[model samples]
Target: MSRLYGDPIEVWTREGEPIQFVWRDRLYAVRRIIDHWVVAREWWKVDDDDPGERRFWRVEASPGQRLGTYELRFDTTGAGWLLVRAWEC
Candidate 1:
């Protein structure tokens, strides 16, 4: 398999939502949704009483209008997003 770019996204229950988006400096008509995933996690120990809060959903995000399929992350944390997984079909 070939290597990809960008970061990991925090998926949720939103349809056709933008995990990442872009508008090229050139032409248009290059929109595509090729990313998908389900994320169910809780921020307990890190958030306090507001802990045990579980989240779930499916997301198909991407990066830029040119390199469309390039994945990226909107990581809630400040360390920046890391590519955890992806789909190629």
Candidate 2:
């Protein structure tokens, strides 16, 4: 596993797969999706009005220079996207 951080970001998707994202003023293109899953809501931790299910993806990406693996997520209840974690190998 990689070191985790809660970094909110803007993402662009194609046919339900994330294709790119903007982080720290730079844009990175997702080269491939390694894995993906849906996280059910934690009802005990959040109110009913809070975001529902969350969809997560682990992907290999590049910012035009260096390659890295990143974990990104989308909230189904309309809270938008987030870059949850990242690492280079």
TM, every model:
0.31, 0.84
The residue-by-residue lDDT of candidate 1 on 50-79, one tens digit each, is 333222222343342334233444443343
The count of residue-pair clashes in candidate 2 stands at: 0
State model 2's lDDT: 0.89
What is the TM-score of candidate 2?
0.84
Winning model by lDDT: 2
Model 2: which ten-residue window has the lowest total lDDT?
42-51
